[model samples]
Target: MYFTSALVSRSLIKNAGIIFSKQPVPKNLYATRLFGTSLQKQAEAFIPKQRIKSLLPTNNSFRQAVTRFCSKAAEPAKGQKAVGWWLVGCSGMVFVAVVLGGVTRLTESGLSMSHWKLLGEKPPTTKEDWIREFEYYKQFPEFKLKNAEMTLEEFKFIFWMEYGHRMWGRCIGAFYAIPAAYFWSRGYFNKSMKIKVGIFGTLIGLQGLMGWYMVKSGLEDRFQDPNDVPRVSQYRLAAHLSFALGLYILFLMSAFDHLMPTKQHAIEITQKALKLRKYAHISKGMIFLTAISGAFVAGLDAGLVYNSFPMFADRWIPSDLWAISPAIKNVTENPTTVQFNHRILGTSTLALISGMWMLSRKCKLPPRAHTAATAVVIMGWMQVVLGISTLLTYVPTHLAASHQSGSLILLSMAVWLTHELKYLKKLPK
Candidate 1:
């Protein structure tokens, strides 16, 4: 009976040991073991030394493992950063395009080409080629009526200006398309981003078409007066400018999304932030509207008439604002009305932005948001100054171009402010 009891006791002890050995150790315990703690020493008696050594990696190996894990985790963030910067570059190209377009218009170079090609034509390089281009220009109404005294050298200046603008636009397409395809193939963009990229591409194509359409309006023999200058349709000009602004906004906003994604903790927005957001939304809309109005101002060359600010022709409102028939026609068609309306809109936008900035100070905004708000106010005032200077100087090409660029800059700031204040979830009442 004593021998049988000894065999059963030994078997029970063996089974208990196997069960304890099969249990997994926590990572903290492994770390503790590595440090040679008392608890680890105590554990060594039960866990086989050979098994412990096999399970615990060397210090260098452990560090390498951790580094690999972290790098894997950061891969997505790195991809997003690349996409963000690419978008920033594209937006910059669009900015240059806008400035170049403004210069082309200011120089009266838009009508110099007189011919349109989708893929573009080779520029005149030789003297004979230059004459051929010049002869072609002479056939257009712009040359016959407006630039009849233009020399070949002068024609070259305008031709090169228009040519540069068109070529730059084509360059934008190539710059966007090649990078976009590579990124898309790399699976960097998700489904929604893919759709936005598609839309952006389509808009670029449409903008090119719209540009040609606007140019065509000028080429047609639709002058009502023999004294009328050959210029593109004001309506077409406004449309073209609007499309460019729209694309700029989209590109900039998308870039912000990639660069400044909202944190999960930012979902619970504060009441003051919510209120400020409303103000920001209004300011953004006003900025856009003011920009659109400036396009009309450019379209009508209205800045030339409004040389005086805070008053037009020494009066608060010009007398012939509604000189054109139907009154509504005067809003866009009449230079006096367009300039007056742009002045009102511009002043109102500035006032609205200034108020929003004041409110932002009390809102306890995020750091980035606070900075964006400050930028918006500063840019708002700067834009106003530029506009006034452009007018006071009688719309010199450089000043006028700067004024146009300033509008987009102001709008960009407004966009930045709004984006910083963007909320992922609904605001609590």
Candidate 2:
């Protein structure tokens, strides 16, 4: 019932190194194959040679196709391409989810959604449902202490903002998990890669849990304003934002690891990468701190505090930077201090990345590595400009969203530069 080298010409199966690309499978098990007699029979001399040739494994056409298919599947390099694209999808989803989260914050819509559920559900569909949802929101501190004047129609706007964010997060999970399982089943991953996917999936689940935790902070009576305005805790907000940014970096790093893996050092390249590594790492830390500072500014509505650029209230050092007690509390717990720190951190990151780029120009480096270093400089500058614009413009929703997206872009460029520089062995000249 199967073709064998014993019966067929040996030259066909053994042709070059391409034909029998993988270990031989039982002849009948090949998914892509010409149908043959379910049961083999003795050769019949009376059978027409032309007709018999069609069923023979030695047929040139059959061998060519099987050669191509098996050649691709058996080669590990080709499989890596498939897995790389799958990771690109995951990374793309993470970027979108981060942007959506920023928009939700800009809209002041995070506290509108009072419940979190595993199953996907639609918003209130009827009068009774709308009223019930609105009443449920009324019971929360956000409505009682701050938004008591919010009409049902106004509530709908913020409701959709938060709802869209949650829905996008759900889509990200679907995009990642479905393709991950498919790629894994197709044997695209090695053992180490499988472990990485597991860890990534686990972190995604934790991000969801953190989302709920952040929302819960604003729903309680802990933090309040003199005007009785209710908002999420800055600490929790910073934690949520930090985790999201970190997750984005993970997706990016893993994607690049598979897609554009570091080529082996050809002819013992320059030592510039060694020095670049130190700068790249410091740049990454600056990006992370800047993002955290942005989170604190958002939490305290501190962007509204100083609408002027290059200075807060026209003062380099605002008088109220430590208005809160215990001194240390003013850094994270005070609006004026938080805004000041964000400005310093953002400006410092811009200066640090610019220095890294300048250092890159003085050494021989891979073209891609140089390009990535350049991107860090350009994006870092863009982030600062956007931050200043977001502040001067009073944190308009669209501008603020752009500012947040800019942070992630800067972060990605920094990570790429860092990864590229890590491969260099010696110090730059």
What is the TM-score of each predicted model, taking all chains together? 0.82, 0.80
lDDT of 2: 0.77
lDDT of 1 by residue, 316-388 (tens): 9788988989989999989989998888898998998898888888766678889999999999999999998
Q: What are the C-alpha RMSDs, in order, of all predicted structures?
A: 9.4, 10.0
Query: Which digits, one per residue and each the tens of the lDDT, describe model 2 over residues 1-429?
Result: 123433343234333213223443333323333333321121122223344454446655544444343332233444787777777777777888878887888778999988889866578999899889999999988887778899999998999889988888888888889988987888788888889999889888888889889999888876456476688888988888877777788888887888788864453455555667788899899898889888998888888997897777768888898888899999998888898899989888888898889988987787888999999999988888998888898999889989988888888888888777656665334
Candidate 2 clashing pairs, residues 3+ apart or interchain: none
Report the alpha-carbon TM-score of model 1 versus the true structure: 0.82
| Position 158, candidate 2: lDDT | 94
